[model samples]
Target: MHRSAPRLSRILACAAVPVMLVVAGCSSDSGDKKEPDSSESSASASASKKAEPTVEPAKFAALPDPCKSIAKKTVTSLVPSAKSKSGTAATSSDTSYRAGCSWNGLDDNGVKGSQYRWLDVGFTRFDSDQSLGSGAERARQDFDKQVAKAKVAEGAKKIAEAPVSGIGEQATKITYDLSKTKEDFKYATIVARTENVVVTLTYNGAGYAGAKTPSATDILKGAEKAAKEAVAAVAGTESDKPSGSTAPSEKATDKEDSPKSSDKDSSDGKSTNRKTSANKSSVKKTS
Candidate 1:
C-alpha cells in the first residue's frame, strides 16, 4: 500500500508542471501581441502629420528710386515751374519695397491768373507669400483696390474712368474735378501694374486768380506719360540690397500725407503752397 501511494503523488506532480508551463506560455504570447513596437509607433505618428502648402514665386525682385523714375524733361513738362525740378521725394521707411516723388508749382503769369500744377508718382512692391499668394497676384489685388479708390475720391465731381493701353501690363485713368482752396482743380490719376509692382501717378492743375483751369485732356495725357516712365523704372531696380533703405534725399510730398498749398517760392527746399497742385488726394494709399 505505501509504494502505490508514492507512485500516485509522483504522477500528480508531473501533471501540475505541464499546467504551469502552459499558463506561463499563454501570458507571454498575449503581452507580445498587445504591446506596440517602437518602429511601428514612429511610422504611425509620421503618417498622421500634416504637410505645408506650396506657393508661387515672385517676379520683380526690387523697386526703383522714385525720385529718379521719371525723366527730367518729362517732370519739367508735367509740372512746368516745380518747387524742385528733381521732385520732392516721399518719405519711405523701406525704399526697396516702397517709394514715391511729387512736384507742385504755380506757373505765375504777370497778369494772367497763375496756373497751378501738381504731379506725384508712387511705387509699391509685393513679395511672394506662402499665405498671401504670389507677388504678382498680390500686386494685382492692390491695383484693383487703387482703381476703386480713385473712382471714389472725396469731394470729386465729373468723375470719369477709362482704360489706358501701352503704359504697363494694365492701366486705368481716372479723371475728376475737385474744389479746394476756392479753385476748381482738374485731376487725372493713372493706376498701372507691371508684374509684382504697382505704379500710381497723379497729375492735377487749377487756375488761380482767374487763370484758366487745365483741360482734363491735357492732365490725362501728362498722367499717362509719367505713369509709363514710372512703370518702366520698376524694371530697373536692384533687389539684392539691404531692406529699409530710407528716402533721405526726398522732401515732403502730398501722398506722404497732405499738402499745405502755397503759391510762391523759387526752387527752395520748403514745400510751398501752389497755384498748381501735385498731390492732395486723401484717399491715396502710401503703403
Candidate 2:
C-alpha cells in the first residue's frame, strides 16, 4: 500500500507539471505582443521607399487669352471688314494651357474682284512631365507637328519653308498656295517656339470676281509681322517691341558689311557726301 501511494503521488506531480507549463505559455502569449508577418512588413517598407520627387519646374506657367493674343489693330489690318471685330476665341476647357483666335473677312471692290482674308493665331504652353520630357522639349515636338501640318495642308501647292531669325528662340515661315472657291489663295504659316510656349500664326487671302490674287511675298511678310507680334504678346511686351528680336548674326553681318561697303564706295572715287547718300538709300531700301 505504501509503494502504490508513492507511485500515485509521482503520477499526480507529472500531470501538474504539464498543466503549469500550459498556463505559463498562455500567460506569456497574453502579455507579449506578436510581431508582424515578414512579407507584410517588407511590403510596407517597400511602399514607403517608392515615393519619388517631381521633375524640374516648367518654364511657362500659363497662357494668355486667345482673343486678346493679337492687338485689335493687327486683327483689323490682317482681316479688314471682319465679320466679328472682337475676334473669335477657340473652345477650350483649359485656356491657361491652350488658346486660339481666328478672323475672316471679305473686302468688296466695285469694278475689280473682291479680296477675302483669313487669319488665326494659336498659343500653347507645356508643363514639365517627369515621365515624358521638359516643357521646352515637348513644345519643340508640337512645333514640328504644326509645321508638318501646314506643309501638308490639303491641296497646297508651291510649298516653301524658310528659317526666320530675330523672331524667337526658333522660328520658321512656310508658304503655299491653294485654290478654293474658284480663287487662288496664298497662305503663310509661321511656327515659333519660345521657352515652353509655341506660337502658330496663319494668314491666308484670296481674290474673287477677277481680282488679283495676293502675292506670296506679301502674304509671308504679313504673316511674319503678325507672328512677331504674337511672340511679343507671349512675352507680355508691346506688339512692336524690339527687345530680344535682334539676332547676333544679323548684327555681325551688318558690322562686317558696313566697313566693306564704305571701302568700296571710297575705292570707286566717290565723295564722302555721295557715299553718305548711298548709305541713306541702302538704309531706306532695307527699311
Candidate that would win on TM-score: 1
Please list the residue runs of candidate 1 whose C-alpha ends up more than 4 Å from where it truly belongs after superposition: 1-52, 238-287
Candidate lDDT values, in order: 0.81, 0.80
Model 2 TM-score on a 0 to 1 scale: 0.64
lDDT of 1 by residue, 1-287 (tens): 98899999999999999999999999999888666676678778777664555567777676776877787778888888999988888998977688888999999997887998999998888998988998989999999999999999999999988899998899999999999999999999999999888999999999999888889899888888888878777755534444433332222222222233322233233454332233543335442
Give the Cα-based TM-score of candidate 1 against the true structure: 0.69
Per-residue lDDT for 124-198 in model 2, tens only? 888789887888889999999998888999999999998999778999999998987878999999999988889
Question: Could you tell me how far off, in angstroms, the CA of residue 134 lies in candidate 2 after the best superposition?
Answer: 1.3
Per-prediction TM-score:
0.69, 0.64
